[model samples]
Target chain A: MRKKPALWGLHASPPGLLKYVLAALPFLVVVLVYLIASDLRHDVNHADKLLPGFGQMLDSLKDLALVPDQRTGKILLLADTLASLKRLLIGVVLASVFGLFLGVNMGLLPGFRALQLSFVTFFSMIPPLAILPILFISFGVGELAKIVLIFIGVFPVIARDIYLASTQVPREQVVKALTLGATQLGVIYRVVLPQILPRLLDTVRLALGPAWLFLIASEAIAATNGLGYRIFLVRRYLAMDIILPYVLWITFIGFSMDWLLRRYMRWRYPWYERGGN
Target chain B: MTDTLASKYQLVIQDVHKSYGEKKVLEDIDLTVRSGEFCTVVGPSGCGKSTLLRLILGQEDVSSGFIYIDGKPVGLPSTDRGIVYQRYSLFPHLSVLDNVILGQTLRIAPWSARSKRKAFVDEAMVYLERMRLAEHSHKLPSELSGGMQQRVAIAQALIAKPKILMMDEPFGALDPETREEMQIFILELWDASRFTVFFVTHDLEEALFLGSRIFVLSQFYTDQRGNGQQIRRGAKIVADHHLPKTPLSAETKRAPHFLDLMESIRRDGFNPAHLQHVDDFNLRHPDSFRTLSPGEGDSQSDRMPQLWDKSQ
Candidate 1:
């Protein structure tokens, strides 16, 4: 028999510390590369807007986060984040309510399924961005249009995912519930609804990416105050400092939402099997 | 006919037939169960025993004929009947206590349920204690062993105080030792509670050991439908036997007569080659009866004399 090398083959298992180091390696490499590139660019052009130095980026962050705007007396970063979060929150909440309603009903009731399945599937297929123009025209390019765009972009997908999850709950469970004296509505709301809630959180977490995409796209095209609006407004001057920080902030917020939802699901539904549906 | 009345019997099925389009599943089915009989049904795979159980549970409707429970036609599934499947009987997201209480909770309005929660919990705990799962009441179904999960499932079903309890291969997923233990446990519960039970399984030994009355439902039976390719014959209750309602024990399973009975059921129900003529079925139970259709009688056996003689 041949001697097996450690940490290099199919038979090899890396220790815990090594595994953590390996996971962080890629992130470290990316930062190192970016820092070197920024330094090199700054040496060639001190006034470079393409890749601002760390000090310059920090100064830009401090201004946007701490200093009030001269015209509006509001911190630019805080104001933009608040505006974007409001639209995102309202849009996502509305989408979740509608999605859960449609999905649970469609999954449980044959008649509701027959009436809605094909139509929702068709609507899901239509590119949400392609209808942005129509939405802007119909609802006007105000907060309503932007929120509607986000809602339209994510609801169908969430509903479809939730429907799939709800259907995966064994027919045995439903029959058992019925035999346990649950009425039709009782089975749907009490039995099916609770079982699918963790799945709902999961679907919402997945929807956040597209929700952010639609929100940013809508704000960039029309909004006067938002993270997306500021990023686009600063783009012409090639203000990489502000753009980079705003982009990182958005990523952080998205990550936190996903993490929070996952934690809540685990805490609330300790019985839920992740990735098992 | 009076003997088969729902008022006399706990459950009665008359000339029941079930099919999905042209694919027949159950045909000319007639059954009458007493209020406290532990009736076990054994059959080959796809013999429609589970389908029959489902029909009685009111989860699915029969294609033709009728089912009566206590003289009222069986409607959609309700608290009057309780079922425990081979698996997924307990709600996965609920703790054992909560699952047991679910039936009581669901029976009342939400507002009333909250006020009556303590009473439901107290009632559920009694059943859980009987199942010896009181210590694990707060644990989720996923946390329990297969046998323990099934015990919880039984507690969950029994808490509702259903008129009849339906178990569809409830012990099929357990290991042999656990299965035997569960068999004894259920027998104890049945003896104590005296709830009418309709248990289904493909395991012949299990059928013989668990049932006070055993029914063999098999598709491998001859009828006037003949052996033509176009003729589709569904499963029928080919045999019914009444076993002595003696005290249940594990040692009884190893007795010679028990093994012999198991062997005969295997031949009668599970063997596709050993087809029995519908007229010659061993319906020896006092409660057993059959309502044969015009085409299902022995007179039509003349058309397929060879098969009929071979079956005899």
Candidate 2:
């Protein structure tokens, strides 16, 4: 009897090169379809607004990135990116700090949990986009409003996720820490907090999508400069070239942030991914 | 009299009863452990062995009773009672060295911990070497094998110099070979340190091998409460034997006397069908005692003649 080959069943795993090819296959197909669609649209109309050709997009990218704005004398893409990233960075950092504090305390302490759990649950349930007008009205249409919008949009979810993660930490660990002479606060801050930080980063990575959504929405509503503002600004003239690249740029930034967070989690907390405790 | 007795014993658990809402877990548990004694508890699964350990550790409050450690009632789990659980004994976030030194670091302020880091590391390294885990000090707990992790946990607990070290099936997760190895290692550690140890396991052989005094806790005994559906009797110490602290050897497990004792304990504690009368429990240990509540053992007098006749 001959031994069976291993490649096409439950026991089969794809080889390394095949695995890479499998991963890239769908992405390549999507790009191919988009190119074909762009060509067909351009053939019908020389200046197609819906699906701009690659050359048209490339020219717009150069203009937005390299050329200075006529009125402000600043490069629009760079300025917008900086503004958007500043808001995003401030909002996410604040959310992470406050979320970690609230979430860990709520999970570790009964009094904190009883006080904040229901309130956070209710707060997280409110659709952030629905409260956009309220945020603008309360904080005004400045940078504060945009940052607040993103903060409100992301923090509660992060807090709740971190709360769940914190609670998932074994009760045995808490008892062990206490037995080790850790004070109540020491157990929370030193023992429980370090263990949950990787989970917090994971929560932040998940919350980044909603953070970007809120950033774009708020910037579209009212902003002089931002990635979202530029996209909306170009949309008025039906400049699909600028809009598409700006959207792609936002995606790239979000993807990179998520990737960086995952990498940092693995690097800093080597035990976390390995399911240490 | 009680004051002197309490002072004499390293740990005194008296008339301890634990219940959760409608379910009773432990009843009338009275155990007095001396300093440097290895008291091992064995029982059937869900026989409330771990519950009794937790109550002594002050991780949970007994429904009614007092657990005094060093003549004082235990309030919350503290450095006085260091525990090594079967799993999750060491913090995964910390390296082996950090885990061992955690007890000292936690007792001190952050700045002091930094300034005294070298002294702490040196002390922890001593324990690491003792546990034969010196080379793995820098590695995280996850990187080590099961037995090694447990060794690290033991080192972590020992560094605290707890009044009574509690281990709840610390070797339960290891393979048989590793478990045997750990048993020998712990016995040596206990012999050298002479710390009061309260070890709980479901393994009868382990209890017999490691304990100076072995307690068989079970819900498998008869009482005035009877076998009615409503009679919710919790586990009690049905048998407590004072075993001689023989020289540590795996070969001793094959001894005829050891096998006989193990067999009798299995029948007494693990056999639900062979429920010994409460009045006739084989509590042979000098420190072993039980408090009988009203009507707990009252009817056992009338049942004794019937039991004797049935056996004859």
- Candidate 1, residue A43: how far the Cα is off, in Å: 2.2
- In candidate 2, which residue pairs clash? none
Candidate 2, superposed: residue stretches over 4 Å from native = A1-12, A274-276, B298-312
Lowest lDDT sum, 10 consecutive residues, model 2 chain B, at: B303-312
Kindly list the per-residue Cα lDDT of model 2 for residues B34-75, writing each as its tens digit: 999999999999999999999998888998877888889898
lDDT of 2 at A72: 94
Q: What would the DockQ be for model 1? A: 0.77
How many residue pairs collide in each prediction?
0, 0
The sequence of per-residue lDDT tens digits that candidate 1 reaches over residues A161-199 is: 888877888988888998888999999999999998888
Would you list the C-alpha lDDT of every candidate in the order shown? Answer: 0.89, 0.90
Candidate 1, chain A: TM-score against the reference: 0.96
Please report how far candidate 1 places residue B92 from its true position, in Å: 0.8
**iRMSD values, candidates in order:** 1.3, 0.8
Return the TM-score for each candidate structure.
Answer: 0.95, 0.95
Q: State the lDDT of candidate 1 residue by residue for B1-312, as single tens digits.
A: 644387789899888889999899999798899999999999999999999999998888998887888888899888889999998898888888999999989989988998899998898888888999999999988889999999998888888888899999999999999999999999999988799999999988888888999999999988766766687988999899998766678888889888888888788888988878788888988988876665676675445434332211
